[model samples]
Target: MRKFQDYRDSVHFYGRIWTAAAILMLLLAPAAICVRYNAWPAASAVLKGLLGVAPIFWTTGIIEVLTYAPMLGTGGTYLGFVTGNLSALKVPCALNAMSGAKVEADSEEGEVVSTIAIATSSIVTTVIIAIGVLLLNRLTPVLENPVLDPAFDNILPALFGALGVVYIAKNPKIAAAPMLFMAALFLLVPGLSGAVGVLVPVGALIAIGVSRVLYKKGVI
Candidate 1:
């Protein structure tokens, strides 16, 4: 708890700054894409927004950063943040108004640099979130049906499922059985999905476990 609190304190301002940067980047992504690809600016803007928010569709930074810490080494958390968030946002984010840089592969201190970039991305995300709140305030009165709020909730599960499948495919030996087992557990346990929000993970894990086990035992 203390460590988390400390991290929060240290990263708070940094996060806010990054979020502001991201909003600017998102706003400018369309123009850049239009120039680069000779695409329509409005269409490009929509695409850019979709891509910018794609990471949120797949996984929250909390989950991505947390999940990778043990997977990498001492610098795992920072690296994970970089890779995960970029995987979320893609190259359009780095080139324009958000203007964060990529980790140069040849640079020895790339990890430290990447950490800074990830922190900035978080800041950009925060700004976007604030904007979201404002948009919600404007839209709230018109949206009486909670079901139609935003498609984000549904899209996130689908995106995560796709990513999980990729991860499972890449590392089936270790990821397969445990994932399925946990998912089955999630299902069998009464009210577990509602309790722990297990549907997405459960489905992803099951697919991985089934695919790997079938492949391994020559069942498929």
Candidate 2:
């Protein structure tokens, strides 16, 4: 009984309640109209893409989130160049079931069109976030040590910090050169943006090589 009380005290139940309340509110709200009208076939295509990818991503946390956004933007933009809307290109976001935001209607080239905002772009995102936090706080403790949260939370920072050090130590002459190279490569390389799953490390290595070459010649 004392252990249960201690767990409750440490876990912050109001936060969970607040989260559930927020998600409940979002569930009760009206979403953008086109989503309501669009055939499930359209929405299903989008949902499959997003849901399939989201779970694989859940464990990656924030860095993956930050990196994937730009990468997918680039990839999706290029993908738009081919396969067309049958690829569901215009509404890349319809892929997720959780998003409920609306897009306005517009006429283009004698066509009327509308888009479903990405699930991430929905006004209800805050509720999803709250629910996620609530679930994490409520559930993780049952399977793991509570203190492990604070400790494991620091892993990303530490790993990136170490990476930064290795980067600097490996190439001290042109600190910004590798960064600029990566940025440029990500931008200029055809179909390379969303490919960051492949591009980042490749770009980083190419950047390091170029920076080293430039530094050796004192041109950087």
Candidate 3:
């Protein structure tokens, strides 16, 4: 217990430092661009844009913390936050790595594995993105081919579909509730597609609540 606790503390300490540095580095790029080009927007314009988007970002950030932190734990969660794209990439990568290794997420090995997986994913994603950017000119014709559009459109669905199948197989009753509701919601209110980030957490909350009820009633 003492050793794990100490490890947890150290993870938190360094996680926070990296998270802060990531934020600073992210902002520095834009700040440097504005300085170099003398292209700073007016304060009012910046505030206007923030007003339009900040609430959505703030809400998603809070929801993600509440939803993702528990599953991801301290180190993976911090790394995910720094790297960004948790819902689409890092969370899946970390969870899949842990599952593949047959490690309980709360175990010492699981924590280390999850963090390493998240970091490795971030590195891989960065490399892929760099390569894409470098070869973008050469790849543009092939990438923009009309035949490939449908495949590109389905990429996200394909990734999540595989995950959904595993989850439904594990516990059909618990998964069914959120899955059905989410399917109906998007079908009925197509506008909510733009709010998928907010809605994903909402669906997770529904699943959690349904599972709790099922557990209490011995349904699971």
* Leading candidate by lDDT: 3
Q: For model 2, what is the error of residue 118's alpha carbon versus the real structure, in angstroms, after optimal superposition? A: 37
Per-residue CA lDDT of candidate 3, range 1-220, in tens?
A: 5698899999999988988898899999999999999999899999999999999988988888888887787899998888889887888888889888988888988888999999899899999889989999998898899999999999789888887787689889999989899999999999988778888778888998999999999998
User: Tens digits of per-residue lDDT for model 2 on 1-220?
Assistant: 3453453344245435555676665655544344676533467787888798875444333333343333233222222222122112233333221122222222111111112233233434556657767898786675378867776767545654655575467566656666666667767885654444444445456666877789789886
lDDT value for model 2: 0.45
What global local distance difference test value does model 3 have?
0.88
Task: Give the runs in model 1 whose Cα sits over 4 Å from its true position.
Answer: 1-68, 71-117, 141-150, 194-220
Q: How many collisions per candidate? A: 8, 3, 0
Clashing residue pairs, backbone N/CA/C < 3 A, model 1: 15-123, 18-123, 18-124, 19-123, 19-124, 19-125, 25-98, 55-88
**Worst ten in a row by lDDT for model 1:** 90-99
Which candidate's TM-score is highest?
Answer: 3
TM-score per prediction, in order, is 0.39, 0.27, 0.91
- Predicted structure 1: lDDT: 0.52
In model 3, which regions exceed 4 Å deviation? Answer: none
Better of 1 and 2 by TM-score: 1
